[model samples]
Target: MNPRILLWLAVGLVVWAVIPFVVPRYIADLLVFTGIYTVAGLGIGLLLGHCGIVNLAQATFYGLGAYASAYCTVMMGLPSVVGFLVGAVISMALAYVIGRPILRLTGYFLALGTLALSAIASALFFEWDWLTGGTLGIGGIPKLDLFGFLLDRPSRYYFFVWIVAFACMAVARNLVDSRTGLMLRAMRDSSTAAAALSIDLQALRTKVFVVCALFGSLAGSLFAHHASFVSTQSFTVDRSISFLLIPVIGGATSIPGIVVGALFVTFLPELLSKLGDIHQILFGLALVAVVVLMPEGLVGAFGKLRARLAKRGGGNG
Candidate 1:
C-alpha cells in the first residue's frame, strides 16, 4: 500500500470519528441517510459504469427489502436478520427473472423497461396494502442490537450503515477489477466483438443486475431499521430516479464517487430548503448545472484538475 494513501486514510478516519460529535443531531441523521443512499447507489453505479445498463427498477428492490424487514420484524415477530436475508433473496430472485428479457433490450428501450418495472412495483406496493400497509405504511420497526449494544441513535447507526456501504464498495471494487469486469467493459464498448469472443452477454448482465438488486435490498433494510418505518411514498419512481442521479452526479465508475453523490443528494436538499419553497427549483437547476458542466461528474472533474496541476508542477520542475 502507498504511504500517501495510508496517510489519507488515517486522516479520513479521524474526520469520520469527529463529525458526528461536532455536527447537529439532524446533520448526523442526514449522514446516516447518505450512507444508506451510497449503498443503494453503488449497485446502480456498477451497472451503469461497468455494464452500460441503466437500471431504473432499483426502487422496487429497495421497497421489497424495506417491506420485508418491516413485515418480518413487526408483523411476524421474526428476527431482523431473517428479514434482511429474506429481502435479499427475494430481490435477487426478482432481478434474475426480470433481467433475462429486459437485458435483451438495448439503450433507451432497456431503460424504459426498467422504468416500467419500477412503475408496476410501485403500483403493487400501493395495492397490496394488506401486507405493505400502503399509504399508512408499516411502523415500529426495531433498531438493531448487536449483542447487548443498542443502535438507537443516529450517530451510532451512522457507523453501522457506512460500514455496510464500505463493504459493498469493496465488493464492487473487486468486481470492477476482476475478469468479469473485463468482459463487462468489452461488452460495453463493443458487444459484437465480445460476442465473437463467445462471452455470455445475457448471463453476465443478469449477474450484475442481481448483484445490484442485492445491494438495493441491503440498503433498504438499513433504511427500514434506521427510519423505524416503511412506506410506499419512499419507494416510488421518483426515489428510483434519485438513485440513478447519484451515480451520474458523482461519477459512475468511481467507488468514492458514490459517497460523494450520496452526500450531495442527502445534504443539498436540506441546504436548499433554507431558501424556502424555491429550494426545489434551485435544486433542479443545480443538478442541471452539474450534468451540463461536468458531464463526467464531480469526481471526474476533480481528477482532471489534479492531473492538470501535476502537469504544471512537472513543467515548472
Candidate 2:
C-alpha cells in the first residue's frame, strides 16, 4: 500500500476514535445511523455499480431484519445474535426465491418489480400489526452485552455499528475484486456478450441479489438494536429511496463511496434542518444539483478534481 494512503488511514482512525467524545450527543447518534445506512447502502451499491441492477426492495429486507430482531429479542426472549441470523436467513431465502423470476426482467421492468416488492412489504408491515406492532411499533429492545460490557449509549454503540459496517465493506471489496465481479460487470455492460461467454446471468444476479438482502437485513438488525424500536414507517418506500440515494449520491462503484453517500444522506438533512421549515425544499434542490452537475457522484467528482489538480501541478513543475 502507498505510504500516503497509510498516513491518511491513520489520521482517519484518530479522527474516528475522537469523534464520539468531542461531538454533541445527537451528532454521535447520527453517526450511528450513518454506519447503519452504510451497511444497508453497500448492497445497493454492489448491485447498482457492478451488476447494473436498480434494486428498490432493500427496505423490505431491512424491515425483515428489524422486525425479526424486535420479535425475537423482545417477544420470543431469544438472544440478539439469533435474531440477526434469523433475519438474514429469511431475507436471503426470500431474495433467492423472488429474484429467480424477477431477475428475468430487464431494465425499467426489473426496477419496477423491486419497487413493487418494497411496497408490498410495507403494506404487510402495516397489516401484520400483531407481529410488527404497526403504528405503535415494538420497543424496549435491550442493549447488546459484549462480554458483560453494555453498549447502552450512542458512543459505545457507534463503535459496534461502524465495526460491522467496516466488515461489510471488506466483504464487498472482496466480491468486487473477485472473478465473479468481472462476470457481473460483463453482464451489466452486455448480457448477450456475457451469455455468449457462457456466463449464467440469472444465477449470478440472484446470488448478488441475495447478498444485497443479507446486507439490508444486517443493517436493519443493527438499527433495531440502536433505536430500540421498529415500525412500519421506518421500512416504507421513502426509506428505500433513501438507501438507493446513498449509492447514487456517493459513487456506486467505489467502496469508500458508500460511506460518503451515507454521510450525505444522514448529515445533510440534519444540517439543512437548522434552516427551519424550508429545509426539505433546500435538500430537494441540493439533491437535484448533485444529480445534474455531478452525475458520477461526490466521490467521483472529487477524484476527477484531484487528478486535474495533480496534472496542473506536474505541468507547472
Using lDDT, give the best candidate's number: 2
* Candidate 2 lDDT tens digits, 1-317: 99999999999999999999999999999999999999999999999999989999999999999999999999999999999999999999999999999999988999999999999999999999999999999999999889899999999999999999999999999999999999999998999999999999999999999999999999999999999988899999999999999999999999999999999999999999999999999989989988888888899999999999999999999
Residue 191 alpha-carbon offset, candidate 1, angstroms:
0.5
Clash pairs, model 2 backbone? none
- Expressed as tens digits, the lDDT of each residue in 110-159 for candidate 1 is 99999999999999999999999999999999999988789999999988
Task: Give each model's whole-structure lDDT.
Answer: 0.95, 0.96
Badly placed stretches (over 4 Å) of model 1 are none
What would the TM-scores of all predictions be? 0.99, 0.99
Our tally of clashes for model 1 stands at: 0
